[model samples]
Target chain A: MDPKVVNDWRLRGQRYRLEGELCDHCGEAIFPPRDICPKCHEPAKTPQTLSGRGEVYTFSTIYSAPEGFEAYTPYTVALVKLEEGPIVTAQLTDVPPAEVQIGMPVEMVTRRLRTHGEEGTIVYGYKFRPASFWHASTQA
Target chain B: MSSQHLMQPERAVGIIGYGSYIPMYRLSSTEVARVWSGGGRGPIKEKAVAGLDEDTVTIAMEAARNAVARAEIQADALRAIWVGSESPPYAVKPASTLVAEALGATPYLLAADFEFACKAGSEALQAALGLVGSRMGDYAMAIGADTAQGRPGDDLEYTASSGGSAFVVGPADLAVATLLGSLSYATDTPDFWRRAYQHYPRHGGRFTGEPAYFHHTQSAASRLMEELGMDPDDFEFAIFHQPNVKFPSRAARRLGFTAEQIDTGLLSNLIGNTYAGASLTGLSAVLDVAKPGDRILLVSFGSGAGSDAFVWEVTERITSRQDKAPRVTDYIRRRTEIDYALYVRYRGKLKT
Candidate 1:
C-alpha cells in the first residue's frame, strides 16, 4: 500500500465527481468538504454532487510546468466558478491556451492527471473543457 | 454447431440510450506520410487522437455520462458497467472500476473489462443485453473506447485512432432500439495480436482480410439473418467493424447489402480505426438519424477471429431521446488538427 494511493483514494469523491458538502444551516456550498460549515460555523455533513458546469473566473497559462507535467507545458489553469456557487481551481483541457477566455463556459470531464513513472497508479480526476453553447443552453 | 450460436435473451431488451466521444485532436494521414514515407498520403483522410490527459478510462467516462444523460436514469441504477478497450492505460488494473466509481455506480455494481480486439465493444453490449434481459438488472451500461496505438512508421499508424461509444441497455418497452436477436461466430485464426508487455500490435496483413475479418463477419451476419429469416432488403442501415475504409464495403456487398445501407454508418474514413470503438461508433452515427421502424444490422469483427452480428429495430422513443446528448456527428465536426510532432508526443511515441 502506497501512501499516495491511499491519499488519492480518500479524496476520490471530490476529485472524480465533484462531491461537495452543502451547509444545512446556511445553504452555502462547500468544496473539499471539511465537515464544518464555513458560513454559519456549524456542523455540516450533507453530501451534494455538483452539476460540473461553470464559468472561468480567471486563468493562467503555464509555460514552465512541474516535473511530471512537463509534457503538457503551456497548459491553462483556471479558477472556475461552479454553477453551484463554489469556485474550484483546476486544469483546463481540450482547449487551446490562446482561446481560453475569462468568462468562457466550461464543463467537467474526467482526465488523467499524471502517473507515477511507468508502474505506478495513474491518477484520474476532473478537468474542465470549453462547453458548447448549444450544450450549455440545453443543460440550462 | 447446428444451432449456429444464435442467442436471444429470455426477456426482450433494447438500447435505452446511446452516446459517443471523439477526442478533440485530429492527425491527418498526410502528416504520417510526410514524416515517415517522405511523401504521398496514407489510407484514410485523418484520425482522432486523445489529448495529453485523455485515455481509455477518460473516454469511457465521458461516453458513459452522455449515455446516462440520454437514458435519464440515475447512475446508481446501473447494475453493470463494462468497458472494452484494446489500449487500457493499465495492463493489470481494471479500467471499468474507475469508470463505475466516477459514474456513481459503485459498491454494488458489477464492473469489468473485456478484450476481444475490435469487437470488444459489441461483446460488452451482448453481455449487457443478457444482463438486463435476464432480469438480473434493470439497467446496464456497455462502453467501447480506445486510445489505440501503432508503431511509429507502421501502416497501422495511419488508421489506429482514438474514440469510443456507449450504450445503456434496459427493458424493451423503454428502448430507443429493441434488440431482436444476435449471433456470434469465432475461430482460432490469429489475424492480429500484441503479446504481453508489447507496446504495439502486429497484424497478419493480407491474412486479416479473407480468412479472419471477412470469414467471421460474413459467417455471423449470414447465420443471424438466416436464422431470423431476414435479408439485406429488410434493414434500413448496416454497420460493420471498420479497420479501414474498404473492408466494411466489401463485407456488406458480399453479404447482399447495398452501398446505401452501409453509407450512413461508415465512419472509419473520418475517424480511422478505433478498434473496439469502431462498429459501436458507427452504430451511434446511425442511431443519430434513424427513424422509427427502421431495422439495422450490425456486424463487428475482432482480430482474435470473432464477429458479433445483431438485429436492431428502432422504436418511436428514438425521436425524443436523440437530442438528450451530443450527437456523433457533432463530435466529428468538432476537431483540431495537430502535426506529427505533437501526435507522437501526445501518444508517447517518443521516449521522454
Candidate 2:
C-alpha cells in the first residue's frame, strides 16, 4: 500500500483504547488528545492513555430520529461515569434496552455508529456493549 | 390524612406545587455544532449548556424555590429532599443538601441523589410521594437538574441544555399537583452509561434505538397503563423523558401517542436536554396549563435498569395559586447566540 495514498486508519485509536494528553501541570487529561495543557494554562503536556474500561453511571434510550441518525432511530444514549470521575455520554449497546441495568458492568468496544452519506468514510469510535461480549466475539 | 373522596384519583400524589430556574446567559446549538464540526452540522442549530462555574445543585435550588414560592405548604413540612441527575457536580458529597438549604427546607429531612439517565427526576418524584403518602414523611421535595454534554461532532452535543425543575409534595390544599397512581419496570443490561472517572462516555449507536429506549419506555409505560386499565388516550397531558427535540416525538408516535399529545415536547427541542431534568421539565411545561380537574401522567425511563411512572390529578389548589411558571418557551426562544468557537470553550473541548 502506498505510504500516504491508502488510508492507514487502524481498527482502533492510538491504542486498543483512547489516547489523551494530560497536563502534567494541571492534572487535566485531554482526550482525542492535545499537546498543551489547557487547564494548567501551560503549553506543556505529556501523552497518556486509558483502558476504555468503565461503568455506566447513568444513561437514556433515545427513541427518535435526528438528521444524520435516521437509520438508527431509537437508540440508547448513555452518560458513562469513567473510573476517572469524568462522565462521558455514548450510545449503549449489546444488552437490550429492556435489560439495561443501572450500575451494570460495561466495557469499551470499537463499533460503527454510521457512515457518512456524501463521503463514504466510516466514523468509528468507542461504544458500550454487554460485559459478556468483553472477550467473546461470536465471529467463531 | 388519607383522602377517599378525591375526585381525580389518577394523580393522588399530585405535584402540589412546582418551580424552575435558568441562568441569565445562554448558548445556542448552532454555536455548539460549529465548534466541534469544524464549522457546523449543515443547517444545524446550537443548544444551550451551562457554564463551568455553575453545577446541578445551583440550578436545582433555583427551581425548587419557585415550586415552593406559590405553594400552600411550608418548607418545614417537607420530610425528604431528592436531587435527580446524571451530571451531579460532586461525586462524593450529596447535592440534595445544597438544594435543600437553598430552598430553606428542614435539615432533618432525608436527602439523596437519584440516578437513572434522564428519568431520575420523575423517579425521584414518585419515590418522594411514596415517602410522604405512605406516612414515612409529611411532605417531600423532588428536584431534577443537569448540564448534559456530548462530544462536539456528536449529535447529542448540540441538543443538550442546562436547567432544572422542582416539585413540593404534601397533604395540603390544592396548589400542588396531586399524585394518584404509579407504576414502573426494568431490564438488567447496559443500554447507555459512563464510568465514574471518564471525561466522556461510550455508547452502542444502533442498539440504543427502539430496542433500548422505545421498547423499555413503551413496554414499562404500556404495562403501567395496562395495570391501571387505562389507554394511551386517557390523559390530557403526557410527559416523557426527553433526550433531544427529535427523540420524545418519535418515541411517542412509536408508542401510539399522537403529535398533539407529544407536541409539548417542544420544551426539550427549545431548551436542550437537561440530563435528569429533561422529561420532568416537559411535565413542568405541561403543568403550566393543567387545570385542577385535569389528569396527567408522568413517565421516566433510565437506561441500564428501567422506568418510574406516576399518574397525577391536577387540583383546585393549583388554580387558587397564581401561575408562576417561567414560560420555558420564552426562555428557549430567547437566544443570546454564540459562535462555534465560544461553545468549544464552554465545552472545554478545545483546550486553549
Candidate 3:
C-alpha cells in the first residue's frame, strides 16, 4: 500500500461528511472539492455538503480481490449518482454483490476500507448501503 | 436500605432517543459444530457476524446515527459521547472520538471509552444520566457495542456475537422513557476475564453460574426492588443481561419476574449474546412494544462480576420517537445467513 493512501486523514471532513464544492457561476458540483470549477472555469467558492443519498448508476462485482483488500473479495463496487448532481465512485456495502442493481437507492455510511497489514493503520471511509427507499424485504 | 440512597436523581432524566444495529451476516449453530467436529447441540440457533469491514466502531456509528435521527436535535447538541465496548478498533485511540467525528459531533465535546464485560453499556448510561441530571449538559449519548470473540470450539463460540445499541439521555420533558431510579452491585468474583494483549476471554466455566452471573444479577435486581419498595409485578416488562437464554430466565424467576415479562427482551435466542450490547438491545426491543405509563426493569451483568439495574417508565413520547429510525426488529429481520467457511472469512479467524 502507498504511504500516502494510508495517511489521508487531511481530507477527513471531505470524505466523512461528503463535503464538496459548488460552482457559484455555472452551479457545477465537484466532489473531492477543487478550487477551480471545471465547467465554469472559475474559482468554486461555495461549499456544499452532499445529502449522502444517491442512486446506483452502475455496478460490478469483484471476484478477485485487490492487493490491499484480499480479505474482502467478491465485493460490489458502484458508480452512484448523488442527488446533488455529481456521480461518485465507491464500494457498496451492507447489501451483497448479487443484489446490487443499477437503480438501487443508497445512503452513505462510514466504514473500514482497508488496513495496511496486521500492524498497519486502518483506512476508514464512506461506503453506500441500500437506503430505506428500497425495501430490504423486497430483495430476494 | 443502604442501596436506597443511590437510586434516583434530584432532577428527572430519561432517554430522548435510542437505536440498535445488527450486522447482516449470520452463522448457524449447526455450521459451527460441523466445522469444529462438535455435536450439533447449541445454546442458540444462530449468531450475527460482523463483516470483514465491520467492527465495534462501524456498528456503533450506525447505532448512533439512528439514535441521533430519533433524537431530532443537532448532533452538536450532544455535549459528550461515551462508548462501552470490549472490541474497540484501536487499542489506544478512543472509539467515542471516532464515533463523534463520524456523526458530525466534534470540536467541543467530551469523549471516552469504557469496558466492564457485558455491563459496559450500562456503565456509560449511568454516566450519561449523571451528566444530564446534574445540568452538566442538555444531552449526552452513550453506546454499548461489541464484535465479540471466541476461540475455536469454545462454548463462547456459540454465544459471542456482533451488534450495538445507543441511547441519547436528556431532560425528562424531551424523553421517551423516564428513568425512575438505578442501583449497582459488585464483587470480586472472577467469573470471566481476558488480559491485555489477549484476543479471546477465558471463563471459570460452571463457576460463572453460581458465584458470578447469578450472584451479581440476583443481588442487584433484588436490591433495586427492595430499595424502591417495588417488585417484579410492578414492571410491565423486564430485561436482563442474556449470556444465553437460560441465565436470564433463571435470574428472572429467582427475582420473581414471570416469563411473559422477560419474553420480549430475550433477543439472545436469535442474535446470540452481543456482550456489551446484550441488555441494552433487549431494553430497546422492550421499549419498542411498551406503551405509555408502562414500567420496565433493565438490569445488565458483567463478569468479574457486577450488575446495574434501572427502573424506567415509558412516556407518551415513545410512540412518536420510535418511527424516526428503523426498529430493532427491522435489523433482526434483514439478515443473510452464511455458512461456516464464509463466517470464518468474514470474522478474519483464519490464521496465516
DockQ of 3: 0.48
Clashing pairs in model 1? none
Give the per-residue lDDT digits (tens) of candidate 1, residues B134-224.
9999999999999999989999999999999999999999999999899888899989999999999999989999999899999999999
Taking the tens digit of each residue's C-alpha lDDT, what string does model 3 give over B1-352? 3424456766799999999999988888888877776556588888999988898999999899989988888888999999998889899989998888788899789999999999999999999999999999989999999999998789899889999999999999999999989988888989899999998899999999988988888888888888788988899999999989999999999889999999999999889999999999999888877899999999999988899999999999998877777778888887899987888788878885
**Where does candidate 3 stray beyond 4 Å?**
A1-7, A21-30, A35-48, A132-140, B1-5
Using TM-score as the measure, the top candidate is 1
Candidate 1 local lDDT, residue A45: 98
TM-score of 3: 0.94
DockQ of every candidate: 0.58, 0.01, 0.48
CA lDDT for candidate 1: 0.92
Note the Cα lDDT for every prediction shown. 0.92, 0.65, 0.88
iRMSD, per candidate, in listed order: 2.5, 22.7, 2.9
Query: lDDT tens digits, residues A52-130, model 1?
Result: 9999999999999997777788899999999989999999998889999999999999898888777889999989999
- Please give me the total number of clashing residue pairs in predicted model 2: 73
TM-score of each: 0.97, 0.66, 0.94
- Compose the digit string of candidate 2's lDDT tens values, residues B1-352: 4322122232244567777655334566556544666554422244565543345766786577667766656666778889998887667668886565444464688989988877788778878777766677767888888877775566666666678888887763444566656776678758678898776656667666677777777776776676667777888777777766565677677767877876774465556667777777777777766676777766677777576776677777666553544545544544555565655654557643
- Candidate 2, residue B39: CA error in Å? 5.6
